[model samples]
Target: MTHTIAVAPQATKHPGPLGRRPAPQSVAELLLRAEALEGFTVAQLAAALKLELPLHNRRAKGFVGGLVEQALGADPKARTQPDFPALGVELKTIPIRPDGTPLESTFCCAIAMGRADRASWEASVLRRRLDHVLFVAHLAVKDTPLAARRFARPVLWRPTPPQWQLLQQDWEDLMGKIGAGQSGHLAANVGEILQVRPKAAHRQVRTWGHGPDGPQAVHPLAFYLRARFTRSILRQQG
Candidate 1:
């Protein structure tokens, strides 16, 4: 039986709530002004690791890292700036499967701080926690790290449980959407934890012509990686 899957245009159109922030104009400026960064540049990190990252990927990682850092370490002088009170943040990429098509570029912002009696801090932190992904996704597009000049302070931030849950959910939803053929581009608001979807039971199985083997679900490890990475990111925050 043939099942026609509907390719939703939602991937291309940026929804009002799932939008990204403005791109950084200058990578150099990003390096100088963001207060959240702890001194490692994307270029420096890649160079140290001997990994030749694409220009865009390098810029995206550094820039997102800086933004996440900002969420953790807010600047007092930049009172006009949006404050982030999250305990920690991380950067990741979602690539398009088919060749020539540009993958949806994004960075996930995990918030670990819980608001209690810290009213002022909570206000600033709430803004950061909520808009963290939007801010970092915008920076990722420009390939620039946060500008130290724009920020007023710095700190070594970490993550907590709530933050881990956020990351897990984001990754799972993203993978599930892609697995379900929601290609072209993805939005930041796709927030359902990856799990056995209701439609998964209705999948149309097809045979693979590879050697003597029939079609089988790829090793569960492929899906396990998502969980593994989530754990790794959490460890980094700790």
Candidate 2:
């Protein structure tokens, strides 16, 4: 079961829950840096999906730890193991507008933690992990009165084992599409190509802030690449 982070509008947004942001090369650093951010404070993270996160009661802190763990390629418990190889990565949470649009500016941070490829490494060792993938996201009602669909909390996503394969496939498809000189092409096709479906439909959650409730649906990784490019995605988007 997925444990949802608590939404507390009044809660302070802490960029350093684990203390000391991770470095770009350090998997742990990257994960820590990403985790330190929140929906109200990290716009860059939300922008990855080409959408905005509304800042109502948006100040929240619980997501930092969980997201950081995910970034580092670790589990929710923040531990790394052989079967579950983890890359030191970070996560940032930010907010978007009501209509899932992007703003002029958004902010977020990423810190690297440990090294996943080192033979002497203590973290889990997965042979094929996306050690350098960053995810920015936006959420909303799948269909509705556009304006009524307010911005939902944004998340920084580090691709998991399951997600990595789909992205890799999308990358191949995108290359094929581009090679064929196809027009009107965007990142959204990757989702279609991978058959990436949302776990829920027409669902909403009440956040700590004052904006509208949660989105009617949440794509597992769509916001970051629904039709856009995430930092990591951009690196491989060509």
Candidate 3:
């Protein structure tokens, strides 16, 4: 079945609730600020930030993360790098069940199907993006209204040595095929923890990529961390 990706633009930024508290100087400062809002509901934070909460959330897919970013005073110019590049931290807002299990996969990064990337695992965009992440979770029960969803505990995390191995292996496997014009054959189950999925903003969106028959139109792809893996990261929260 085809997925209709939402293209509705997010509302423009308004003055932050804290009047743009000076950008976080250190990781400690960032976490402290994030933790302070651990129990705030979406309504409370949105009101504070002057955001007009939407009546229907279908067009607000990344709304929560944007709210948290503004709350923490993230710089808008650094969209291509980690959300908080000053502290080498990527801000990720994950939705979780009331019991702490993730509700869906966490978006990792986009893949340029036709472009060559760094061969070194340590130098890859995905590696740097996942290097240091500040995860702020929110309760996402199906029946819960968006405004009433509470921000849960925040966790600062970096993958362990063992975890990195698995991730790197999957990265190699996927990139190998993607680089070799075999993208058409990659199944959804190709990776153990990381998976590549189409990331278009609409059903008909397409991009250039290699296939067995050489360059061809391909579905744009983005990497995602399976919910099972994210649940483990939250479990290991420090």
The C-alpha TM-scores of every prediction are 0.24, 0.31, 0.88
Ranking by TM-score: 3, 2, 1
- What does the lDDT read for residue 139 in candidate 3? 77
Candidate 1: list runs displaced more than 4 Å: 1-148, 192-238
- Name the Cα RMSD for model 1: 18.6
lDDT of 3 by residue, 37-140 (tens): 77677777888877788888664448888888888978777765888888889888988876678878889888888863325566777898898988888877
lDDT of 1 by residue, 111-189 (tens): 2112111223224333343333212211122333322111111212334567546645555454444444342234433
Provide the RMSD of all predictions against the true structure, rounded to 1 decimal.
18.6, 17.5, 7.2
Worst 10 residues of 2 by lDDT: 108-117
Error in Å for residue 68 of model 1:
14
Instruction: Provide the overall lDDT of each model, using Cα atoms, as 2-decimal numbers.
Output: 0.30, 0.32, 0.79
Residue 164 miss distance in model 1 (angstroms): 0.1
| For model 1, the run of ten residues with the poorest summed lDDT | 147-156
Q: How does candidate 2 score on lDDT?
A: 0.32
Give the alpha carbon lDDT tens digit for every residue of 1-238 in model 2.
3223322242243233232223345554553443343333333333332334444422222233233333333444433322123444433333233333332122221111111012221221221223443443323324532223222233334556766666556544543433233312334334432322222233352212111232222112111334223322323321
62: Cα error in model 3, Å: 1.3
